[model samples]
Target chain A: MRLRLTPRDPSYFDLFAAQASYLVVGANLLAEILGADRATRKDINRRMAEAEHAADDATHTIMRRLNQTFVTPFDRDDIYNLASSLDDCMDFMDEAADLIVLYKVDELPARVSDQVQVLQRAAELTAEAMPRLRSMDSLQEYWVEVNRLENQADKTHRKLLAQMFDEITDPILLLKLKEIVEKLEDAADAFEKVANSIETIALKES
Target chain B: MRLRLTPRDPSYFDLFAAQASYLVVGANLLAEILGADRATRKDINRRMAEAEHAADDATHTIMRRLNQTFVTPFDRDDIYNLASSLDDCMDFMDEAADLIVLYKVDELPARVSDQVQVLQRAAELTAEAMPRLRSMDSLQEYWVEVNRLENQADKTHRKLLAQMFDEITDPILLLKLKEIVEKLEDAADAFEKVANSIETIALKES
Candidate 1:
């Protein structure tokens, strides 16, 4: 779809898209971290911290843009919510990675990797969807697709959580894994918040 | 401070204040549920559900207002965030109450009541703070006090959880009580979010 030629540039939305892309990159780093042993765990955490910093930087950039740009590609409030929600996704990913690294978890739980992969994909889709918001067209279609992807992530999360509950023996392990899974799942939920807000914006515009 | 006229009429903000007050009312009902004995549990649950229904009505009212209003008394995004956060508090309280009711907890746990009471008071403060947004001219000082109360609630929550962990015996009881305390504490956290947003709004206006 061709981008709508609004009176103002869509730089704020572009910054938001970049923020989400950075989160996807962070999720990939987490996936890579799952393979590292104890010795490399610290280094992996350091790398994850760097990714978090990048996400934070993206957040500040979006905020600054929001302050300066009178005419946003989307609703000003939607831009703020989307920006913060993307940052939250990164924050959760960094936290999960930090816990694994700090606790010296014996092994990377399969569900952790799976959830990160789900988040990575969701972040990608969110980034892709942002540009489309600039166009005064076909947004409802994109909204539906994002909603479907979000629902898929939710289902995958619940399935993985049930699996984790069935397989884990130690109570501490169970609790930690439950938290990680819930956090990742919640990140997807947060993404859905952004999508829902975008839908609101689109409907209002139309 | 005199009430400054808002960008929108009194009805919109009045609805928000009413919804916030409704949540506080739900918190009180939740506290009552925590005080009930096992035999009287059914009655407690019924009252709690009634409170929850009222809270849901408040949420719907706020959402309708948000959708219809253009120029708001405060930042439109902040207004939405405040309403959603307040509704989330109600949702959590209802969930905890429902769980206890379904499980037929033998008696009111001290930790459960402790957290609920703190949450109840915090919600009250939040309800009080909501209307102050209408009068940015007069209630700037009240915003600070509300934040301090929220901070106090957080410290209380942490101390309560620590005491709960240290004092509780019976593994199953410990688990159940822990979840209840966490949910109730989270309700307080939601109140804090509302308070913080109000503080921000106050700062912007002042």
Candidate 2:
């Protein structure tokens, strides 16, 4: 066992970990909003906006540090990409939450909960994985698990799409539900992107 | 007005031009299919697939060359981004054409024709812009115009969405048209991304 003596700024890991933590907040909020009443959902959406803003701030901090700092723990491009993808995860989840409130849909399909659960799991994995970037140990499991979860999310999304088309009768309601589900799917894709970025970074380091 | 010898690969521009030209083929096919009967639309979609395949090959050529070459005309990441965005333009347009055929919609709202027309013009502008990367001359107009066109397309899309909800009563038909329009809108966004990438490369060179 050895301590890293290189002058790499160790705080980039902390920054990334901070940024990823918001994903968990945003995802959990998304899960909460789905089970909420209309008034409660509006309140949860307000909280989601705050969480998104916090995530955005965390990202800006990383970018600012990147701009000023000469050296980084990884390739600057990879850092930028990882940060952007993390922000995307928050943005997509926030959009899903916002749309649910804006569309005033009384209920989402049961499969949507399945979609949100995948996001929550992916977010937790990402949060856990970020701190490990410095050590770069056991990262293979994190990315591989996230990838598997994303595939599951994708299957759920297609089924939900087909099911909605078959069962939903009102075009306007159908439009609202379709858009909301798609946003959740986008969030899932964004999570996969983050995992892929991590995999590239880990492979390069190794 | 003098050029000293630099060992930058000249063919990257040609590769990009080939890719952008497919967007024109794609955008034009999208426009043509909007006017064609179902039989002809199917044929146009077949041709669109061929154009998309050509575009994919062009992107692969660039990627292969990028991996092999030491010096690029611009930043390697910028080149990668520009190529990816160009590919996105083709993919989104191809998807729109495919969905139009798959959905078997008899008619699209007239504004959708306006959307395709915007894509056609943006594609032409992009094809024209590719050659100018060498000099980085007069690129301001290309990106600026593409941004303006994207804004217009966004407005058109929102209006179209509102109108569809207000007018269309059939849920199935609404889903088909909505998905198709969103794909067209996504194509417009992808074209704007290409322009944005070019803008970055030009700014760095300037």
Per-model CA lDDT versus the true structure: 0.69, 0.88
**Best-performing candidate as measured by TM-score:** 2
Please give, for residues B10-70, the per-residue lDDT of candidate 1 as tens digits: 4657766766776776787787776668767677667766766666666656665666667
User: What digit string (tens of lDDT, one per residue) describes model 2 on residues A96-128?
Assistant: 887787667888899999999999999999999
List model 2 lDDT by residue over B107-145, tens digit each.
999999999999999999999998888788899999999
Q: List chain B TM-scores, each candidate.
A: 0.81, 0.94
Q: Could you give candidate 1's per-residue lDDT for residues A1-206 as a string of tens digits? A: 22222223436666666666767677777777788787787887787787778678768877887898687766677678778877887887788788787666777566566667767777777767767767746666656776777778766775675565456657677666667667677777777777767766765676
Fnat for the candidates in order: 0.00, 0.21
Give the backbone clash total of model 1. Answer: 1
Task: Give the lowest summed-lDDT range of ten residues in model 1 chain B.
Answer: B1-10
In candidate 1, position B42 carries an lDDT of: 71
At residue B89, candidate 1 shows an lDDT of: 80
